[model samples]
Target: MKILLATDGSSHAQAAESLLTSLPVPSDSELCLVAVVEAPTWQSDVASEHAALREELAGYRREVEERLEREVERLKSRFGRVSGVVLSGNVVEQICQLATDRQADLIVAGARGGSKIRRWLLGGTSDRLARHAPCDVLVVRPRDDSAEPARGLKRVLVAIDGSASSRGAVERLASLPLGEECEVIVFQVLAVVRSFRMDIVEQSGDLWEAERRQAHDDLNWAADRLRPVTPHVRTVLHEAEYVADEILTVAEEHRADLIVVGHQGRSRVSQFLLGSVSSAVLRHAESSVWVVRTEDADVS
Candidate 1:
């Protein structure tokens, strides 16, 4: 497998590196560690300040390159192949382009980076990359202080909604080289729209029952598909008004190390017009989140 590890030299990035090391990827898998250096803008045109700016940029470039090389060397000791690259451009666009050029199977990144203000003003790199990347994206959140120390990728929680995108997520999970010890919990959240009137409840009882049965069928189908990948598999059906909240609650209850969900494959314009559920989970989930995009989606 080919994997792209995007870094910004922050503590969060280091945590992502640690998470990657814990995964059970093939020995022949290749890892590329990339760092993006955004172009800087100056507010003044003073000659001395311009020279100072140039010197500062050059020093920063050197520091970043050195740090990237060290990281590559460290990964090389574990994996059979590892490489590092330093690029300049828009951070999100450059990372996506690199992933496309390499035909990477997965892209891994830290959920938060060095610049809090920039991330707040512009959406974080992990969020944008997950929305736009050509392949799957794994966003690693920082370790929670209250939770116990996790040994590795043991428990995984996947949310399914009976969409093609959801099926694609299951297929991706099955294709991964997770070890035998890994346990997978396939969960489906059934949204119940309630009416306050007693007459409406009586009229919709049959429809509600049918919907519940369909949800159970879908959950069982997903579980069956995952059985070949790992022996330890289970299914859960949750009914809630809010799907994302229910997913997070189940993940916490399971003590999951990873949460996998499908991207709705909404275009940039439509995504802005209609909000995304995957984006909400990506932003709020405490566990590492993997947003899988279908192959038919336009990755550009």
Candidate 2:
């Protein structure tokens, strides 16, 4: 498999790199390490700072290139066949172009990069890459001090709500270039765990235990459906008040290095609302996340 891993030197970015070490890519498979540098623009008010800013920007680019070189060297030692490519341009645009030009099978990146709030408000670089890239994408989170990294995906946790998008996530997981020894933990979370119907509002059920059992059964059924793809898979059911919290908990308990989930488009009304659990997991999980969305009109 040919894979492109993008980094920006953030801890979250390196977390993505760490996850790749556990993937079962063949020793002969190719890996590309790319770090993009967006040309710095000077403000009119700070015109006098142009030369200084340019120098500083050039220095930063050199630093990133050196970092990429070292990382590629380390990766080649592990994967046996890997190369590095560094470029200066718009981060998201450059990554997409590189992935398409190289016919990369997968593009890996950090879930949240240098600016989380900025990305959230103005659309994240990772989010844009995922939407526009030609191949599958793996958006990994930084290692959280509160959580320990999984040795490997001992048990994979998948979130399915019976959507084709979610199903796509399952299919992608089945096709991952993983080692034969790896196992899977398939599961799902009910976003609205409880809903009150008092007055006109729907409320969450008080029978939380029963809801949990039902959720478990749903996940079990999904796992059974995936048995053909992976015989070593297990099923889990979780019922929590919030989706993201439940996912992180399950990940910590199962020690999952990779979390596979399908992307459900956000409604316009909800776009400004709290981000989805998958996004939250991307932000918080001490693991790699693969978000499967419907194949777009643009096919590489």
Candidate 3:
């Protein structure tokens, strides 16, 4: 496996690095460490007048490169092949392009980065990468100072709908080398959509019951697909108005260390419900999130 890790030397980035140690990767796996230095947008129009600014930018870039080198050296002790690079440009684009160029199987990054305003308006680096990366993206949240680090892939929660993308997420989890002791919980949420008050009082009751049964069956199907990967597989069917909220609630109740979901699921009335749900979970979940992109997705 080839993994690309994007860092900005923040505590969140350090959390991602710490979490990498617990993942079950092949012994010969390679790791690529990357850091991006943002080029200053405010420079004098005249080239001669901007010489000092260019020098300052060069110095900053060198510092970033040295930091990445140190991080790579530290990770080399754990991974067989570790390398580092410093890229200059937009953080999200450069990271994604590097991941594609390296043919990375997975991209690991922190949920939040150095810039607050950009994260507020444009979403964090991890959020954008999860949406656009060619491969699976793991968004690692900073661990609570008082909490203990995970030992291994102990408890995992996966959100599943009947979409091909959701099944793709299941397949990806099944392909991972999670140990026998790993426990996986397959969760599916049934959203109750009501058009009118009369529907809510009359038609909604029967519809809810029917949906519950179908959700149970769907959860079973997802659990079966994951059975070969681990024996401790469980399933949960939840009925809620908000799918993402239910998912996060269950994950917190289960104390899940990782939450896995597809980037998009079946479209309803031409709207992609899973996309919004996945985005919400990515932004708010306390556990690490693994956003799986289907093979049919336009990775470019």
Each prediction's whole-model lDDT (CA): 0.79, 0.67, 0.80
Worst 10 residues of 2 by lDDT: 265-274
lDDT of 3 by residue, 28-76 (tens): 8999998887765764688775887778778877777888888988888
lDDT of 1 by residue, 1-300 (tens): 899998877767787888888877777889999988875677798999989877876777788899999999889976879999999778889999999999998898887777321342115677888878888899887657322226678999988877667788898888766768999999888765565888876887788798778878988898888888788899998888767788889998888889998886322113211035788788888888988878753443
**TM-score of every model versus the real structure:** 0.87, 0.71, 0.87
Clashes in each model (backbone N, CA, C under 3 Å)?
Answer: 0, 10, 0
**Compared with the true structure, what per-residue lDDT tens digits does model 2 show for residues 1-300?**
788998777766777777777765666678898887776445656766877777877887788788888888888777757888878767888888998799887888877666211232114777667656677788876446322245555557786654556667777776654444667787776554233546322333445455556666656666666676556777765545676778788888877767787655321123211246556766567667776655631221
Worst 10 residues of 3 by lDDT: 115-124
RMSD after Cα superposition, model 1? 3.8
Tell me the deviation in Å of residue 237 in model 2: 3.7
- Let me know the TM-score candidate 3 reaches against the reference structure: 0.87
lDDT, candidate 2, equals 0.67
Q: What is every candidate's alpha-carbon RMSD to the true fold?
A: 3.8, 5.8, 3.1
